[model samples]
Target: MTYDTFQPHPDLASLVKCYWTLEVPPAADSQRQRIVPDGCIEMIFTLGDDIKRYTSADEFIIQPRAMILGQTIEPFFIEPTGYVNAFAVRFYPYGFTSFVTASLHSLANKETPLELLFGDTPAAELEQKIIPATDAKERIQIVEEFLFTKLKSEITIDNIVKSTVGALLETNGVAPIKSILKDDPSKRRQLERKFLNQVGISPKQMGRVIRLQTALKMLLNRQSDSLTSIAYESEYYDQAHFNKDFREFTGINPKEFLGHENMELSSIFYAD
Candidate 1:
């Protein structure tokens, strides 16, 4: 398996987290990989064999060749049919809304084909250019151009939403929404409405996901000697609180996460 991430263009740096690519050889004993939410949206392009996203214990569906994976509230499983090669753009929590008119809440927890968001002709053209790109740099260039064309001229992110997201990220998702808006607690309802339309989840949900991401990296990197210490560092109430949240997002306890076969792909993502 090979995974790498590249910096986004300066003009798009604030919105796009990074452009990433993954290539893996077909394995004889591959197991279904678990994918957990990470508080970000992704635009993905599959360049190799099709992959299957399990809808249930046995049912599954082929992921779109070019699609937008919205904010997922729960964990899901995916398995490669054969070789795996993919290029994707990881966007900030509020970034994608700047380029599309659809309410993000409608896209939560599922994959929507690019055509549905960008329309058939534009989406197809972009996919064609991306499919034949010679390298990650070329693909990045292609996607950036497409995004630039779609970017709104005026600021699309509402001030309250951007600042709240900023506060959540700056504190590694542990900051309380009320503290962020101590000056105006009445705005809580307003923020929730905006979050659903722009971020696909409530502010609290995004915060929890972000907090879990911090703890996940700590586990993946072996930064701490124990889960209790990690919980303290991550601002969870206690080891029990940490374990419950971890299980909720990852569908497994932290101890079982490391060295777990199904976590190979997820580990690569968070470890980086």
Candidate 2:
């Protein structure tokens, strides 16, 4: 397995978190890998064999070759059919809203093909440009140019939504939403409405996910000697509170996370 991430151009730095690529060799006994919510949206292009995203205990669907993976609140599983080569754009929680008109809430927890959001002609043209790219550098250039064109006609994110997201990120999701709004109830309500339209989840949900991401990195890196300490550092109420929220997003306990075969891919993602 080879996994890598690259910085986005300075013009897009605020919106795009990074561009990433993953390549994995064929395995005769590959297991379904679990992917958890990370409070961001992604535009993915599968450049190798088909991958299956399990929709239920026994049912699955082939992921779109070019698709937008919207904000996912729950964990899901995916397995590669053979060799895995994928390129993706990781957008910050509020970044993707600048490129599309669809309500983020409507896209939550599922993969929507690019054509559905960008229309057939534009989406197809972008995919064609991406498919034959010789390397990650070329792919990033293609996608960045595509995003730049989209930005010309799209509306920027609301100030309230952008600032609130910034606050959540700055504090590692521990800052209270009400406090961020200066305790204005009216602003809270307005933020909630715009958050759903722009961020795909409630402010509280995004906060929790961000907090978990902090703790998750610590755990993966062995930054702390115990879960209790990790929880404290992450500002969870307690170890129990941390475990509950951890299970809520990851579908597993912390102790099991690092050792689970199904978490191999997710581990690489968070560890990076």
Candidate 3:
């Protein structure tokens, strides 16, 4: 397995975290990888064979060649086919809305194919042009050009929603919605509605996921032997609180996660 990451265009930096590429050889024996939410949307393009997303035993679905993965509230599993090669653009919590017109709230927590968002003709044409690019650099350029030209006209944030998200992130998911909305309770409710539409999870839920995400990295990296220390560092109230959240998100405790087959490949990327 080989992976690389790149910076996004300056104007898009706030919304897009980075562009990333991953290539796996044919014999890599792909394992199921879980992608957890991090307060962002994403756009992915496969350069080789297809990828599969599994929901349960005996259920398999092929993802679109090019798709937008909306903010996730929970983990989703993916397995790549032989010689898997792909490039993905990861959006910041606020970045994807700039390029889209249909309420940003409408795409939350789901993977919508590009053709569904853009009209078939336009999306089809863009896919043809991008898929032909022989290298990752050229492919990145194609995506950047499309986004820049499409989003040229308008870039504005819904103030109330932005503030709510800001508060949630700033507090490391420990901040209560009431505390965040003390300035305006009405705005808090509005934020929840908008989050449901655009991000697929309420501000509170996203906050918890973000906190767990922090601890997940620390555990995989062997940063500390004591779960209590990691819990404290990640802002959990106690070891038990950390364990509960971990089980909810990953269906396993911290100890089991390290040696789990399903988590093997993903563990490497988060390791120190």
Model 2: residues >4 Å from true position, as ranges?
A: 153-155
**Alpha-carbon local distance difference test for all models:** 0.94, 0.94, 0.77
- What is the per-residue lDDT of model 3 for residues 43-75, given as tens digits with 9 covering 90 to 100? 888878888988775687898888998876666
In model 2, which residue pairs have backbone atoms overlapping below 3 Å? none
**Model 3 worst lDDT window (10 residues):** 263-272
Inter-residue clash pairs, candidate 3: 15-92, 15-95, 105-197, 105-198
Task: Please provide, for model 1 over 128-181, each residue's C-alpha lDDT reduced to its tens digit, 9 standing for 90 to 100.
Answer: 999998999999999999999999997588898999999998998988888888
State TM-scores per candidate.
0.98, 0.98, 0.90
Task: Tell me the RMSD of model 3 versus the true structure.
Answer: 2.2
lDDT of 1 at 23: 99
lDDT, candidate 2, 114-137, per-residue tens: 999999999999999999999999
Q: Higher-lDDT candidate among 2 and 3?
A: 2
> For model 2, what is the alpha-carbon lDDT of residue 212?
95
How many pairs collide in each candidate, listed in order? 0, 0, 4
lDDT of 3 at 86: 82
Q: Which regions of candidate 1 deviate over 4 angstroms?
A: none
